[model samples]
Target: MAEPSTARTLTTEPRRTPPAPRSVGAYPLLAWTWMRAMAQYPVSLLLLTFGQAASTGLELTALFFVFGHAHQLAGFGINEALLIYGLAGVAFCLADFFMGSVERLGEHVRKGSFDTMLVRPVSPLVQLATDEFSPRRLGKVVPAVAALCYALAVLDIDWTPARILMLPVLIVSSIVICCCVWTLGASIQFFIADAREVANSVTYGGQAMTEYPLAIYGRSVVRTATFVVPLAFASWQPALFLLDRPDPTGLPEWLRYAAPGVALLMSLAATLAWRTGLRHYRSTGS
Candidate 1:
């Protein structure tokens, strides 16, 4: 999936980078520094924030128009579909906001800043993950939370104890899965350049998949989203549980409860992939 056109020239020989720093404080400091840097530019902040929300809004608007004609999608009313969109948006936006720095790994690798990360006494992964935390991204979160709240108000699902408990878990698990997707993509930067398209296709495209009910998708798509890629764990499975809907796949009713576990597994897998990629690094010789 890595395109050579965007890849930087480097030796094929691989070697290990430096060990991580033990200082825990470097992480908070790095995150705070990134926040302050963003604060210096209010206009950029506004644009970035509004731009993300606008993209999600456009998709929602198109869905609205579709509903205006047909009144439902895969048996979901507009508000029900909005619920899926909102939950997915919150999860995706939170990942983009919190772990956005992962997106910059390619640039760091190309510019040799990744070496700087190695020289530091802190963990390179943590440093890179926190390097770009834009508080303005929370602006996008506002509308998403609003949509979710609207869904909760309008959807006829009963809030059982499990549902109430899983609500927060859903948001948390979605965030983790999205970050793992970003980390996996960023890891590709260690092996090749401009993995952005591949990463976006998986991460953002996965979110796009989540914006709709999974009931309409075919068996292959559902399996890919479940066992292979696990997008369903982030949105669809949880939605089914919360909404009291049955799994069309007939896999297992308990699958909905496994969101957090799925996220955890993905995070572990991503970390392993990143570490593997790091070991293969033949630096740019900068």
Candidate 2:
């Protein structure tokens, strides 16, 4: 009787189910934390943001001046080129502002600080991106957004409801492309120990290439960028849609909508590569 009663009591006690994993919110939770932290470090952030703004503004101004005189390259005008540059600018800076700090993976691994990241409940990549928020690079975003807005106003955008809808979609595609490139560079750090130069080339090269008509480039370069690096969809293809110019590259019109999808796929691939690399992660000293 005593044993039966004890067994019943034990069986009646509620079993604690493990907490369900929280859904990743619409805005990356880590990105929100970074925005808050940047708010806290106001002065340093402002100075950096302003400095970046000044430098980038000068570069864009120079580009405008040079291209303005010529008026066209490979059947593209100054305004059209600026549109491409402006969009690419926002993409690159957002990636830097959000996850730029993570580009220092080699240093973190070398110093053995990566282990500290491993112990956390959240992802190391998320933690890494949030670790340092540069308030200054945010200066770049304002001008880029302004340029985009102004360009849309000044240029004939053929603003149908569908085209209008695609505007925000284009910006997101740009962001994904930039972040994917950055993430890919960071992933290489897991293997090469110090992939800084190669990383810079990949990130900066894509940005530089997107500033002009990709059509002028040779087939070999174009193929390498298309299948290998994937800079084509981010700027080249979408620019065709924006300029109302038919894609001379023979890519379909419907493909413009696919840019964001391609970007998402690339980002997912980079993430999977990151996870696989993490499994083989040998902290620098070991």
Candidate 3:
């Protein structure tokens, strides 16, 4: 009792919880900084943008020439085919512009600089993407949007309430699919070390394929593309649904509405692959 009275009570201050993790601000700020950096080289940026736009324009030109002769692909006339191509362009532009770094992940891995992203508070993926954001890539949007507008002007859709709402949703789903495909490509780097060429084959080729009717491909090819890679879900079926066109490949009509779900699943798969790859990654000393 005497000893207890003699000892002064020691009070410990309650620990304050760390401030809530902030993800919302990090990416926007990082993206702004990166955009500023791109602004430093006005002419070079202009040239890079022009180059991208020109290349994509040539792609659309090729499609025009093909349709000019064939006049139709599967059941898709030039107007409908152009609709698919235009939406696909918009989808690819959104993905490539926002997440251009997905292709160069191997280089980052080789340099071991990707490790730096792991120590940050925000998501490594978001950080990587924002760090690599290219403002110049937005130039491609001009041609893509132009194509989409041309399609809209030419095609006569039912344009019901659901279709109106689905337009933005379709656009978003397209972006998600394209981005996930790019992420999948980056994930492959963990296994192959340098698979940019392979990844490009899938993403760029898949993108090109999406611009046309899948019915044009062989049966086996269409089956693989639908069930395996599923790139067709990005824009083709959505275009069919939004424009009230029929699917010549005989997929269920309801499948058109499944674009958002497919996009989510692909995104989850890509994320899982990225985490798996991250665990397997061996940092190079350089």
Candidate 4:
């Protein structure tokens, strides 16, 4: 009878927005985990580190032998040659320590393990590079630093303000160039599963070539290194600026300052190659 029934109001709680996904700390986390695992075996780590140092030390010995045969190589005195060797060694060792593991991409692709990296919420490059990170690789830096110090002390360089600034810039650019080369070489693995040897020939062989005066390799080799791979920027070109020396191959004086730009271009090329390789990758379907 009575039409005064109060209508019940339906109330709904505000929907809470789901929290955003957290950023993945890929490289630091994986690298730390590997470092912890390696720490569990102290003696093995020490021995492996020492072995790495000894192997690189032999390269220095070879340099001394080269100098013993003559006071100058390709018109570069012993000190100048040592400067090149030291700078190249430091750059290569630093690059290898960080990016060397990328070379295993071929093995990962062959075994179908690379597929797992694709599904993770992280860049595969960081994961692959930090995988099984080893402290032993830092061992090579010891001799390289020592050699650099000795060369800097003994070389009669007239260090102007520009040269002083160029020293660190050159070293940093060389490291970037070397790392780019590693990534570029690793990109080849996506197409050629067994191309590790070929990649090594480019990355390691380039390092070997850079560890001395490019002048010793003849004009043809110098030209190839300059225009083809740009390996000359890793040590030769910027080093000439640092030492206030002329390019033995008669490259333009401005080329001495081109290392940083070359490194940037190499970085862009490497990044593009890696992305293209990833797009073309086919899973092993294991």
Candidate 5:
């Protein structure tokens, strides 16, 4: 009793609240996440990068050899051909680097992971795409851009402000075109549940188309690619503007300037197709 009376009351401190989590921008965060995750596998990263460089270099060499024996193909000379090819390579590399995982959307949807995405606060498409950023694909980009720069220097084409501006237009337009083709490919998963090879036909096949002048292919094939898929707008058409070649398709000179526009249209169509496919997605029972 005497001890309790003598004791002074102790003051207690209140607990501090934790800080709120910081929100991150989608693109930068996605890129960082990809870089960090990819860095974890140093050996695999190096192998992919070097492998892409070698394969592309070899392919270009073959094209050089072919054109060395012949004057030109479809009005483009060897050096001009390389310039176009290199530009396409850069476009492909950049597209594949960022949007490569679009190829895997089928599997994600089939596995019900797409459903999991619907519950998140972030935009499903953006989050899913960000989660899949692949720097390993940059393996192709480094050499492709390097080759493009080299090709530009070696080639005799006159440089104009308009031509210089076309470079970025070509890259962004190609990305949109590829994304559209990929969405079309992904839509098959809704019906077949597994149509990877067929989808790849567009992804890989589209990339293949970029390696040559559109005129090398038969008129029928070119028409199908241009009107049906609009792949030609990404590389072939804009290329005409850069090379100062006349449009044999009777398409106006301004049409080449519409590469980004065509790409946007294709992308919208692909999105509509995707929405149609999503409604058709039948998730397996848990």
Candidate 6:
């Protein structure tokens, strides 16, 4: 009995380590989560999407009406103008789809909900941008894509290898520049809580401005957009190159290829602004 008692000992399993936290896939995961939530009510999503598509269609109709009356706008024919509109629309839609929700930063800051994002493992920018992700925004892309495809099909251009490559490059650069502008706008909210309208003026206003030939605007306005705001690179400059048209504003033809460089610089500035804003952020004390 004593020997049996001495032999009575318990054995346990080895302890397992916990998994590592996510570094990547955080944005898509959060965006997908909100998307799934929205998908629960398919009818509402469809209606909202339809509304978006309809609104975009109306804008295109207005463009057609304008073209019907005037065969050319600012020296650009119907197809050329449509190319500009389509390029601007696609770029703006993509930026808005990805980063538009960042505009609500002011609301989050005011409600003190932004503090919650700081405690999470994911990036605050990623969290904010992916918040309330909706598929309705994608509906706007349909008309834009249709316009682009139609323009590309009808527009008679000498498509070179370089020109063909520049098409995607211009689109990508425009998207990046728009995204940077959105980030810069969001960063401004860190200082001024009511800057949403001002930010929208830049983002939305820039989209509207780029949808047509820059030649329609005054030289001062065109220069401001080109050198100061760099919005010209979004559509006008690249479209000039694509159409083999000269700059009515007297800007150098080489500026057409400068979109990528401008986009890189804008990216740097936006990143710096965002980091500075984050460092200066104060909790709402909720």
Query: Which model scores highest in lDDT?
Result: 6
Name the TM-score of candidate 1: 0.87
* Candidate numbers, best TM-score first, in rank order: 6, 4, 3, 1, 2, 5
- Candidate 6 lDDT over 37-65, as tens digits, reads 99999999999999998987888898899
- As for model 1, its CA RMSD to the true structure in angstroms is 10.4
Model 6: ten consecutive residues of lowest lDDT? 1-10
Per-candidate TM-score against the hidden true structure = 0.87, 0.84, 0.90, 0.91, 0.83, 0.92
Clashing pairs in 5: none
Q: What lDDT is reached at residue 122 by model 4?
A: 74
Candidate 2 weakest lDDT stretch, 10 residues: 18-27
> What CA root-mean-square deviation does each model show from the true structure?
10.4, 6.9, 7.5, 7.9, 6.6, 5.7
Superposition-based RMSD of candidate 2 using all C-alpha atoms, in angstroms: 6.9
Please identify model 4 stretches exceeding 4 Å from their true place: 1-25
What's the count of clashing pairs in each model shown?
2, 2, 0, 0, 0, 0
lDDT of 3: 0.83
Question: How does candidate 3 fare on TM-score?
Answer: 0.90
Write one digit per residue (lDDT tens) for candidate 2, span 1-286: 3576665544577789867544355127766677788788788777877888987787678778868688777777777777777777778878787777778888889988888988766678877776665567688777766776676677877877877788778878878877888888988899998896799897877777776677667566766766677777766766777778876655567766777778978989899889987998998655
Query: Best-fitting candidate, measured by TM-score?
Result: 6
Model 1 lDDT per residue over 160-221, tens place: 88788889987899889888988998898778788877888988788888878877786779
Pick by TM-score: 3 or 4, better one: 4
Write candidate 3's Cα lDDT for 194-265 as tens digits.
899999998889988888888889677766777788788767788889767667777778888888898989
